[model samples]
Target chain A: MLETAVFVIRRDLLLAMRRRSDVLTVLLFFVIVVSLFPLGVGPEPALLRTIAPGVIWVAALLASMLALSRVFAQDYADGTLEQMLLSASPLSVIVAGKVLAHWLMTGLPLVLLAPVLALQFDVPQNFLGELMLSLLLGTPALSLIGTIGAALTLGLRGGGALVALLVLPLYIPVLIIGAGALDAAAAGLGAGAHLLLLGAFLVMAAAFAPWVAAVALRIALE
Target chain B: MLEAIDLQCTRGERTLFSGLDFRLRGGELLRIAGANGSGKTSLLRLLCGLLAPAGGSVRWHGEDIRRLREEYWGRLVYIGHANAIKDDLTAAENLAIACALGGHRVAAGALRSALDQLGIGGSEHRPARVLSQGQRRRVALARLALSEHSPLWILDEPFTALDARAVDIVQEMIASHVARGAAVVYTTHVELEIAVAVALRIDLGAAAV
Candidate 1:
């Protein structure tokens, strides 16, 4: 079963590698969104610093969600999901592997890209590490939770906007604590409490979201 | 061997079929005959455990399929009407991927040889997306020859898009697999053109409740 999960993750990663443009667009969107922030809100260093963490986290959330639609949608469209269903592996494991792969392509890149975006916002050098950390821990939860919305809207015509509608409400807590963690660092207070809360959310999502997504997938496929 | 006992399947409020019993044993090929919307694909999906039956049971080796799903699935290979091959991958890559997904490993040379047997050697390197429909079907059929672990093969419309030569090759492969003690369940609108001595036919038209 674990082997099948690993195989799925490996297969998607290989597919992503071959279709490099898909992942590239997410990065470009990240850059464009971050660049737009400075242009839209004037280049005031202090103002950019004040809003840097929140802006980056929001962009990461939306970008990750954008990238995630293609995750199961492609497999579902191509009949791979049906084959996966027929395989010996449990559906939850398949969902977990897919969520993990979505994180690798979507969340990991967003985390790695956050620091550069943070710099553009003129965030203090002292707070860059904290910003990146918050994103790394928070983005997986975003991907994990985002999958539920993706699964729910799997075959819906206007799935993209519907995914945003379904996920943003569920994403509020993570967004609050994630930005709070970085804000605490900037304010010279301990960010540990917020980061711990973020980790807790990750644990909770990792435990339940895949099962929910699996059930949703079964419905969508049916 | 695979068998469905008094199986009843329904979708929504509509009962698709009822009291359908069929069996495919080692060294035997069974054909599922039905008209369009006669629940042929649904029946295949149910038999492979992709969908649940509203009533009755599916058994493999005398054990309920749901109870022994892993063992049953490990021994079965199903290729539906969709072809189920990733277009981005080459013909050889698609077969290797399928073999891997089925929990069996095939060496590169052996995989090439299998593709060669299906007369797909010349296009092995090209992406399957570019292959003609007949070639793609041949690529999927090639997996049956390469994987040893999947003893029972369930194919839906296995000859949907194939040339005369390709169809002949597929029939030969099915016959050989059955001769090697692997049970086969397949559906085809068109009749099997080749002369196989005997086959059990379950016409869904007559089996309808």
Candidate 2:
């Protein structure tokens, strides 16, 4: 199982490396959308600081959503999904590997890039740690749950929009807790409870989402 | 043994086939022959445990394949109608990933030779998107060489985009696999000059009501 998971991760990373433009596009989208909010909402430092948590979290959500539809699209298009289903390893194991790889490719970048983007909103140095922590804890859940949506919408016409519709509702809890953590920190309150809840959500999603996605992938293939 | 007993398939209220039974043992080649829309692909999918039959069961070694699951799948290799090649990866990279996924960790030299045998030798480092349809098909077919340890092969129209020379290469590979006592179940509309003595042919068109 470990071998299969590692093989999958290596393969996906290699593919992502070959297609660097896709990864760059997602990063640029996150950066651009977050940058545009300061322009739209006016350049009041107080206002930008007040809205930083929500604005950054929302942009991260949209950036991750932009990548969700592609989680299974390439594999399904080329019939690799069928081959994956037929492998000796359990389908859920493969799904878990793919989800982990997806997070590594899409989610981790967002987490790493968030601090730099947050500085644009004049977020204080103290709260930046909390923001990054919340993202680090919350984005895996996004990738995991988004995988279920991706599997459910695989091969459908206009699936990109449909995947966002299916996944954004599920993402609300992560967004709330993630942004709420930063908000609590900025207000001089400890973010422990919110961070703990985000951790709980991650645990729940990690435990269940891969199996659900695997079943959904089978249905899509059928 | 691979067996399908009274297997019935219905796609969206349309019955594709009913009361289907067949057995494929080692050293046997079962060619599932049918015209388009005749459930040839469906039956292959069922045999690979990709789709559940509406009735009956597909069995391996007298155990239901669904129950056998990974153990059954471990010994079988199925190449569907679509060549599962990634456009961004080179032929060598594609083959390596495919082989790895299929539980075969082939060496780099072995991968190159396999692609060479399939007539894509010199182009192994080029992205699959740059390859012609026949070359891409050959990349997918390269799995046949690496899959020698697997006992059963389920190929769905393995010759679709191949030219005459490539077709002959694939046919020869299939024939030799059967000679080595590995069972083969394939669906093809093209007539193949395989060197097997009386390869079993199941015409799904005639079997369908």
Candidate 3:
């Protein structure tokens, strides 16, 4: 099982590396969207600082969603998904590996880019760490939960839009807590509680999302 | 051994097949012959435990496959209508990933040889998207060359996009596999040239529920 998971991760990462443009598009989308917020809202430092956490978190959510739609679609189109379901390893194990790969491809980049984007918003140096930390914890949950939506909508017409509709509602708690942590930090309040809650969400999502996604994939294949 | 007892299948409001019964033991080959929309693919899926039969059960070695699950899948190699090839990846990369997912981590050298055997030699580095349909199908069929140890092979339309030469290559592979005491269950509209001793052909058009 472990070997299968590692193989899947390696395969997906290799595929992503070969198709460098897809990854770049998601990264550029995140950067562009975050940058546009400042231009649209004007250069009022206090205003940008106050809105930084929410704007960045929302952009991360959208960027991850864009990546999530392709998570299973390509595999489904090529019949790799059926082969995956038939593998010797349990379906949930493969699903978990794919979700982990998705996080690495999409979520991790946003977390890495958050600090740079946060700096553009003039977020305090001390609070920048909180923004990155909150994203680091929360984005995995987004990827995990978003995978369920991606699987549910696999192969459907207009699936990309439908996935966002199904998943954005589920993302509210993570977004609220992730952004709230940075806001609390900026207000001299301890961000620990929000960060801990985000971590808890990650744990919950990691435990159950793969199994749900597996079931959804089976339905989609049928 | 693989056996299906009174297998029934329904999609939406239509019943595809019912009371389907068959058995495949060592050194046997069962051909599921059917017209389009006659549930050939569904039966293959049911045998592999990908789709649940509305009635009855499928068993491997006398144990229900649903209970055996991974143990059963570990010994089975299934290739469906979709070649499962990634367009962005090379032929060699596609084979490596497919073999790995099927619990067989083939070495680069082995992958190249397998592709070569399937008549796709020296094109391992080209992305699958650039390959012709016949070449792509050969890449998918090359899994058979790497999967000699698996006990059962479930293939759906393995000859769809193949040229005459490729078709003969596939037939030779299947014949050799059955000659070696392994079992094969496949769906094909065209007649297979396999010469196994215990060949059974069921035409689904006449066996509909």
Q: How many residue pairs clash in each candidate?
A: 0, 0, 0
Each prediction's DockQ? 0.53, 0.80, 0.84
iRMS of candidate 1, Å: 1.6
Shift of residue A184 alpha carbon in model 3, Å: 1.0
Poorest 10 consecutive residues of model 1 chain A by lDDT? A80-89
For A70-99, candidate 3 gives per-residue lDDT tens digits of 899889888999999899998899999998
User: What TM-score do all the candidates reach, one by one?
Assistant: 0.94, 0.97, 0.97
Could you give the CAPRI-style class of model 1?
medium
Considering only N, C-alpha and C atoms within 3 Å, which residue pairs clash in candidate 1?
Answer: none
- Per-residue alpha-carbon lDDT of model 3 for B1-209, expressed as tens digits? 89999999999888998898888898998999977889999999999999989999999999999899889999999999999999989999999988988987888999999999999988999999999998999999999999999999999999999999999999999989999899999988787668778888988895344
| Ranking according to lDDT, highest score first | 3, 2, 1
DockQ of 1: 0.53
**1 or 3, which is superior by lDDT?**
3
DockQ of 2: 0.80
Runs in model 3 lying further than 4 Å from the true structure:
B206-209
Q: Model 2: number of clashes?
A: 0
Q: Give candidate 1 misplaced runs (Cα > 4 Å).
A: B193-198, B206-209
lDDT of 1 by residue, A116-161 (tens): 7778887778888888788888999999999999999999999989
Worst 10 residues of 2 chain B by lDDT: B200-209
Q: What is the TM-score of candidate 1?
A: 0.94
TM-score preference between candidates 1 and 2, better one: 2
